[model samples]
Target: MSNKATLIRIAEAAGVSISTVDRVVNSRGGVSPDTEAKVLEWATRLNLDRRLFRSHLRTLRVAVMMQSPHNPFFEALRDAFSDLNLTMADLRITSFVHYIDVNDFAGTSRKIEQVAAGYDGLIVTCPNDPKISEALRRVSRKIPIVTLVTDLPDSGRIAYVGSNNRQTGRVAGELMGRFLGGEGGDILLVLGLQRMAGHEEREMGFRSVLRERFPSCRIVAALESGENRERAGQVVLDALREYPGIRGIYNVSAGNSAIVQAIGSLGLTHKIVLITHELTEARRQMLLDGALDAVIDQNPRLEAQRALEVLGRNFQRGESGTTGGEYTPFQIFIRENCPTISY
Candidate 1:
């Protein structure tokens, strides 16, 4: 009968104890660098396969909390993360999705606290409230937390995976100003949630740039649409009625559908310069239909991939990974170069 070499046999050949071999094979602690290398070499030569050793590998379960999955943008992000899970062979990723009414901060915070308990890590869109931030902080003390899409102010999150929203906003403002040809008139700003850091930064950057560069153009009013398309449409309708001289509109969130509908109903397609964020199907169609002037896209697929990469790196290193600084560039989509919407 032929004898099969065991892990102990490999350790003996490498002149080390079985415990040392165990440490090297299981990727545990307390092995000298030279001894670890020798043990690995001997194990490889003996074909001491370590595939079973993966049972000892730590499994990372992460939760991704966001608003309703019905939105195409969130759906795209979910799809991207799912694809990432299929591709990563070394790590096991479990994604937990929670749907919260976009404007209900308290409900979102409670959900976050609940899910944060079961997972090793969290990837979340901020809920824009102190309670949510407190919940994130409390949970972060136990596990790593990554902020996705929107950021929580003063929250000691590990990393933020999203675009430079303020820069994108400035770009929108610049485009709006140029499209207006320096003409002076009131502009209506339709927003989804004011407390979302992304939305807030975008609005602030847009306002700052427009005020400084195009002094004549005035943003007369900014209204929150509560993340509802119908509400957004109603708000725009009210704004148009209130400010008859509105020459441009800036949409800083997901209510582009409402903006387009309101503008269409008013028959002001060619009259107002409309700019918005995100490149969802609706926005792309609006751009194609000439109802929307331009869109500042954050590229949800890239953002999703980056979030996973960051979490994976943090798991491997036991700390936040380095920012390579180079990121998927924020894209400016206009009618001339906008991609066809598949969703």
Candidate 2:
């Protein structure tokens, strides 16, 4: 290995062939965008002095569209994304946050299209709809895109900075199983919306783990309520009333407070094992009152920070450096280790 990174070293670091590295570093062509970005990421990390492949860092006009305006967690995420003064690779960043109706696919697509030409980079938490994906694909042709929270992988975004939903789900399963202590019974997965990529992944992971490790635990139903609190509450109440054998619940999406209310109304504060997402104030109090079992939280501030970092790296170094393009580690909070902080 050379003290200064050579083409071979960069190729090895990037897990590509030397010729591919040569093509990317020398702009010789015949390299896919993802491969080029990975090579440049290695070059940047290795300090290889390959300035030819690196762009001159400029003010990045970044537009960030977070979750629905009604979601405080998403609101916090947006606030953090805009307020950060942090930088990576010496690039100056100016972020503009946009709120969109996650369900309004057409309106969201219009918003994306309107901002497409004006922004240098886009960070969005959009629905996994075909039209929205098409719009992102079109925009990504001109500027790099970093998906936040919800991923639009088919959209060809450069990188993602959000929870490893599947792993978080597995974490939930492991914890919930341990809490159940072999008294296996049915559980419910309440989703804020059906088929949201993030929620789907989490459900898959949770179900897979439960099947693999706890065969006796049955997932009776996977319900969706569009994140409507009242509907979520009703679903919970109905599930409780209908299923007498259910001993555990995993809410894979929003409306944690509503679920908690249903649990309280059913007087299941101690009888049922509840695992939900987000560490909002309602959830914090429930955890304190011991009304819930566990809360799976992905910090919006961290997600925002990683999104900005990846966006910077994507445009400047042609790579998204934050944890190999996966970022914002998820946390499992209980009353014992929960931090007492006001969001």
Candidate 3:
């Protein structure tokens, strides 16, 4: 088709003026994301020159927001985003990792609003706070938003890129039950904030599995570590003192190191069956050393890649073609099966 004919078709399909399509096609940068996505979808469908599409595409700045890197899991996620950023230059995609202090809900909400204004898209993993959800809903009106790791289903996000958190919890429960060798014993749950949907789902799943499948196993105590190492250790030590029969421990969020230390200080490392999430270096070492029996893990690198891909698809195909959640696969890591890697 002639250039003029192609322009006409795209303009008609996108319901924009030919001059608007011209600006978008030539990368003059006056179009909104929604309109640009429409034009690009039409251009792709009409088989417009691939070179033109690729060479003239606008640069997309994506902000990846998560908790502070003090937590090993969030630190790994930050690294994943940084590493992936180097390889997505061909797509003209630039990702910036932004840390939010989940401990301060109001501050986190304000930070999200500020970051949203500066980026074309966002990938966030935050607590399900009312203020944060409201901020996300407000910013989503102007730019695409994808929830990562944890999900806020009602927060106006285009998609959630992560594993099935509930299933992860269920798997952890099964492992804990089986590792206890059929003799039911007290189990302790050390979890992150209850406001994080992912953590909540995991706790519920873990509890349900124990109740239905392993009736002999009882959750003697549930502690909120708030992802703090010192706090995790203190709470866990206290719980152990209170519930001496606790034979299994599930670390749902972070602070694996603290949990290990607590168990070791009490000389209960050999007696407790410990399972946690994320196979970070510290956790891997613990697993190998018999401090932890198993880990319910997910790939942060893959999740980061998929989050960016989801944003890219939304930018290219518009809301009609791209708006859904993706469940990244989770793995069970034992000392024998865990891969040896620097990460």
Candidate 4:
């Protein structure tokens, strides 16, 4: 009556060698037809039902809807998520990573709905579009939903695991202001996508802090920097030309290279303060070279790991150790403290 299977018992009952039992159990196919039938007959009667054997050991398939490949920060986050996927073997979880075009909001929504049908759960970097939110609502009725990096407030996701973007924005704004020497000067806010809930929250936080705390610093312009460096650089250059009074830049997205290039072209690298998110090698070098003054990073590795924890708990029907959303703390790095490695 024991549920646990043992090779010795199987071999004795089948009147076969351990090797034959091993072959039979593993489907290695060397026994005669009559012997194979006998082994299978006994195995079934002994409660060696393979499908039922694993009914309690579940496999949870989770689909991860991430961002376009163009954002360097997301690229780093992708790597972290991949590594985390490799470590989930013990939890019986597998990650299916899918990238959505940054410009195609409708396509992203469709993909989410399609992916939901195949996966047991979903983890997405939430988009601001209501279409995507509606898709999530429809799909989450069947499976659990965990919103990563970004969050969909009204979407009834089980939990959110990421840094608070608004706070990240506020920190960036405060740093940019203080680093600008507190003298009244126009500031620029650049983002990769305006419709991203994460970026919008960051912009909101940056604007609110600047308005309330840094009265001297004015946000003269807030513009989009396309995902690519070239497009981002061009947008920044045109913004620079249009707003020559810009004294500081707070990049809420992954266009730091373009913004840095434009600032360098205008010979304002040292004169104007630069604060961006993430700590890529390029950003680290920029920090060392005085091109960028501060960086706000939501440790992607931690975020990825926490995301798995939440999903794993949900799949097991266990407590997630939190009442509501869980946020990975953000880190602020200056030139002196910025680590040389990228995460």
Top lDDT prediction, candidate number: 3
Per-residue lDDT of candidate 1, residues 275-326 (tens digit) = 9877887778888888889988877777877777777666654565334322
Local distance difference test values of all predictions, in order: 0.77, 0.78, 0.87, 0.78
If the candidates were sorted by their lDDT against the true structure, best first, what order would they fall in? Answer: 3, 2, 4, 1
Q: How far is 285's C-alpha from truth in model 4 (Å)? A: 0.6
Q: Which ranges in model 3 have alpha carbons more than 4 Å from their true place? A: 1-49, 320-322
Per-residue lDDT tens digits of candidate 2, residues 89-167? Answer: 3446788887777778899888998976788888888878999999998988888888888777888788877888788
| Ranking 1 against 4 by TM-score, winner | 1
TM-score of 4: 0.81
Please give the distance, in angstroms, between residue 171's alpha carbon in candidate 4 and its true position after superposition. 0.7
True-structure lDDT of candidate 2: 0.78
**Candidate 2, residue 166: how far the Cα is off, in Å:** 0.9
- Tell me each candidate's TM-score: 0.83, 0.79, 0.88, 0.81
